[model samples]
Target: MDRKTELKEKRKKIVAGLEETYQKLVEYKRYKKSPLIIAKNGEVLEIAPEEILPTTPYITNS
Candidate 1:
């Protein structure tokens, strides 16, 4: 095994992941309000609010 080989393998994996994400986004119409939502901060537990909530709410990062 060599350094170049390892790098090529890593790059391949990254490209595969990016492709998968792109496909998911393209086929996202079936999934409305995706259950697999990402919460990058605190107070993100409650989703699907009926009314308007303040944007830029106080949410601490993990």
Candidate 2:
């Protein structure tokens, strides 16, 4: 197989297992004491004790 096809197949296989992983992360983020949870490019980031502002008021006033 070509290198591009090999990489695509590898990515597909990696993505196939992510559903369960994301489910577990959602549950953990809900229960854990963190305000932000981000997953990107194979990295997981957690921001603790952050503030969540109401965006609707800010958006409508502009």
Candidate 3:
């Protein structure tokens, strides 16, 4: 295959791998009462018993 085709294929593979890894992250879930802190200057994420990882991100492009 041509270099251009090879580059495209590599890009596709990388995107797929990233997508797969992103999906597997543990923070994608509904939190009934997860602890958090409101800050005056900046937002604060209170530490949970465990890091809140879910199946997906809070928002997704597609």
Candidate 4:
């Protein structure tokens, strides 16, 4: 394989690994029933899944 192709393949593998790790984190958090926390302006905030707003609008047919 060419160097460019090799680099692309390596990047793909790294991305896949990151995705797998993220999934595991999600499962661990769910099992522990812990909310995601972040710090902003020297204040800590907890965010649960339900607290997140949807990006897409809901559509309904009359």
Candidate 5:
């Protein structure tokens, strides 16, 4: 593989790993009934675990 293709593959792996980690974090928060703290529009907000939507349809590897 060329350098560019190798870099792209590495980036994809990194993104997939990050996404999986995020899902695990969301699951942990839900299990503990904890709030998810996030920043939106320069404001910090605490979202309930029940209100957390954990998945995005951006990367489909299959």
Candidate 6:
């Protein structure tokens, strides 16, 4: 593969890993009944677990 192609593949893997990690984090927070804190538009917000929505669909291995 060309260097550019290799870099692209690496980036894809990184993004996928980050997405999976984020899903797990959301689940953990929900399980712990903790809030999801985020910063947007120079404002900090604490979203309740019940209000937090996963950015990706939940995947299960069966």
- Best candidate (score: lDDT): 5
Colliding residue pairs in candidate 3: 26-53, 26-54, 27-52, 27-53, 27-54, 28-53, 28-54, 28-55
Q: Which stretch of 10 consecutive residues in model 2 shows the poorest summed lDDT?
A: 53-62
Looking at candidate 6, what is the lDDT of residue 7? 83
Model 6, 1-62: lDDT tens digits are: 99989987897787789888988999999999999999999999999998888876535342
lDDT of 5 by residue, 11-49 (tens): 888888888988999999999999999999999999999
lDDT of the structure predicted as candidate 5: 0.88
* Candidate 3 residue-wise lDDT, 1-62, digit = tens: 99989987897777777767755443332234453333655866564525544433333343
TM-score of each: 0.46, 0.37, 0.44, 0.63, 0.86, 0.84
Which 10 successive residues of model 3 have the least lDDT summed?
24-33
For candidate 4, the per-residue lDDT at 22 reads 62
Q: Give the top-scoring candidate (TM-score).
A: 5
**Model 3, stretches more than 4 Å misplaced?**
26-62
Off by over 4 Å in 1: 29-62
Q: Choose 4 or 6, whichever is better by lDDT.
A: 6
For all candidates, what are the clash counts? 0, 0, 8, 0, 0, 0
C-alpha lDDT of all candidate models, in order: 0.51, 0.56, 0.54, 0.66, 0.88, 0.86
Better of 4 and 6 by TM-score: 6
TM-score of 2: 0.37
lDDT agreement of model 3 with the native = 0.54
At residue 36, what lDDT does model 5 achieve? 94
Tens-digit per-residue lDDT, 1-62, candidate 2: 99989987887666656655655555565576556666878999765633422221212221
